[model samples]
Structures are given as C-alpha cells and as structure tokens.
Target chain A: LAKTTQPISMDSYEGQEVNITCSHNNIATNDYITWYQQFPSQGPRFIIQGYKTKVTNEVASLFIPADRKSSTLSLPRVSLSDTAVYYCLVGVPSNDYKLSFGAGTTVTVRA
Target chain B: SAVISQKPSRDICQRGTSLTIQCQVDSQVTMMFWYRQQPGQSLTLIATANQGSEATYESGFVIDKFPISRPNLTFSTLTVSNMSPEDSSIYLCSVEDGARGTQYFGPGTRLLVL
Candidate 1:
C-alpha cells in the first residue's frame, strides 16, 4: 500500500471553489487515485476517481499529473452542506484490496 | 452503489461485555470489510471477512479481539470481545462493488463502553 499525505483542514466560503491536493510520492503504476467524502456520522461517499489526466463528474473533478505522484480534488461552487472530511486513497480497485484511509482533510464550508 | 445497513445503530455497553455488530448488503458482494473509527481520528481497517473461511485481520487487530464472520455474500458480523473504554468507537462495514470499481459503506454502529 502507498502512503498518502494531504492537508489536515481547509476553510472555504459558500459559492467558492475548494481544491484539496494529495501527494503519494511512492504511488505504484497499478494504483488508482480515489477520493471519498464523509459527512458527520455518515459513511464515506465516493466523489471521484482517476488514473491519470483529468476526470470530471457531476459532484467533483479529479486531476492527476503525468507523474501520478499527486492528485487534486476540485469542488466547484461549494455550499455549507458540502463541509465534510475528504479522503484520498491510492490502491488497486479490487475485491481483495482493502482501502487504507489516512487522516483526511476536513473541509469547512462557511457561509 | 449497494444499500448497506448495520444493526443497533448505537449502543452503550459495560466494560468486559461483548457486542456484535451485524452488516447486511442489499446485493451479493465478493468482499466485505470491517473498520473502526475512534473519536477525532481516522478510520482503521479491522479485517477482511472472507466467506466460508477465516477472516484476515490487519496489523494491531486480532481475530480474538475483533472477530469477524462472513457466512454468505450479503451478510457479515463483527464481535468486539472484552470491551473497555478504549474500545468505544464507531464500527463501520463496507462492501466492494467490483462493477463500479468502488466500495460502499454502511451506517456505522456507534459503541460506547463504560
């Protein structure tokens, strides 16, 4: 499993964009970068995932550099309800692979 | 995404007692996992519940401490034995959606040991 490092916390205002970056210097070639959002007392929800380049979804966008050593999760037009802990995991997506979660970045969306 | 449910959403248990948390998925899944989240801390993988065989536990976790059972594809249970105040945390279960290439988690079971 690859170790990941990210911000401890971030503050963003409503209607502003929030971007959280994660660095996995030892990321493997078979590993994929995935992001999950977790609300208070709730399970983590899948936000976006990408192997390389940029992948956009309705909820968020994932940008991966060619080196694949780092990835960014961009949340556009944030709202107060978007405040949550976001986790970035790097691993192979398979039934046998267990996800290792790091100290996630807590994004506080203020009004 | 799979609809996952856990039993006894929250419980307060006495020290030395044991609690079993049940996890059920709407559809069959090949993999199920148990995780523990302490207050103000990140989630930790407890074990991987394998059907028909013994579970594979992670480092710092043992089968005697955090026993897991996966009788079938859609259901699994995790037993916390010899509980203490240090064991108080939220226990969550997750299933892998191979088709979606992601995992979905259940509403965690909150346990408070007194």
Candidate 2:
C-alpha cells in the first residue's frame, strides 16, 4: 500500500475554491488515485478518481501529474455543507481488496 | 451508489459483552467490507466478507474477536466479541459495485463500551 501525506486541516470560505493535495511518492503503476469525502456520522463518499492527467466530474475534479507521485482534488465554490474529512487513497484496481486509510484532511468550509 | 443500512445505529454496551451489527444492501454487490473508525482517527479495514466461506481478516484482527458472516450477496454481519472500552468505535459496512472501482458505505454503527 502506498502511504499518503496530507494537511491535517484546511479552511476555506464559502464561494471560494479549495484544493487539497496528497503525496504518494511510492505509488505503483497499476495504482489509481481515489478521493473520498466523509461527513460526521456518515461513511466516506466517493468524490473523484483518476489514473492520470485530469478527470472532472459533477462533484469535483482530480488532477494527476505524469509522474503519478501526487494528485490534487479541487472543489470549486465550496460551501459550509462541504465541511468534512477528505481521504486520498492509491490502490491497484484489481487488488484493492482493502483500503489503508491515514488521517484524512479535514476541510472546514465557512461562511 | 448503493443504499446501505445498519441496525442499531448507536449502542452502549458493557464490557465483556458482544454486539452483532447487521448490514443490508439495497442491491446485490460483489464485495462487502467491514471497517472500524476510532474517535479522532481514520478508518481501518477489519475484514472482507466472503459469501459461503470464511472471511479474510486483516492484521491484528482475528476471527474470534471480529467474526464476519456474509450469508448472501445482499447481507452481512459483524460480531465484536469480548468488547472492551478500547473496542468502542464506529463500525461501518461498505459494498463495492465493481462498476467503477467505487465503494459505498453504510451509515455506520456507533458503539460505546463501558
């Protein structure tokens, strides 16, 4: 498993764009970078996933560089409801039987 | 995304007791997983439930302490035996759709042991 490093917490104002970056220097070739958002008393929700380059969805966008050493999750116009812990995981698709989680970045979107 | 539900959303148990958390998925899934999240900490994978066979446990987690049962594709149960205050945490059940490498999770069962 590729260990990830991220900020312990981040603060963003409403209507502002917030970007959280994760470092996975030991990522493997078959690994895909996935991001999840977890709210209080709730399970982590899939926000975005990408193998390389940029992948955009209705909820968020994932940017991965060619080296695959790191990735960034960009949330445009964040709101108070977006306050939650965001986890970044790297795993081989077929071999992703278990996800090793680290202390996720807790993003607090304020007014 | 699948709709998953767990019984007894929250419970308080006495030490040496056991609690079995039930997980039900709205649709059949190929893989089901159990996780434990300690307060102020991240989630930890407990085991992977396999239908009709023994579950695969992770390091530091034994079947005797965390027994898992996947009776079918749509339901599974996790029994936390010999509970202690250290065992107090939120237990979550997740399902993999096998569609886009995404896993959906349940609301989670909050357990407090005294």
Candidate 1 C-alpha lDDT tens digits along B58-94: 8999989988889999999999999999999999999
Which 10-residue span in candidate 1 chain A carries the lowest summed lDDT? A91-100
Candidate 1: where is the Cα deviation over 4 Å? none
The sequence of per-residue lDDT tens digits that candidate 2 reaches over residues A2-101 is 9999999999999999999999999998899989999999989988889999999999999999999999999999999999999999997657557788
How far does residue B22 in candidate 2 sit from its true spot (Å)? 0.1
True contacts kept of each: 0.74, 0.69
lDDT of 2 at B77: 96
lDDT of 2 by residue, B41-64 (tens): 999999998778899998889999
Question: What DockQ do the predictions score, one after another?
Answer: 0.73, 0.76
> What TM-score would chain B receive for each of the candidates shown?
0.97, 0.97
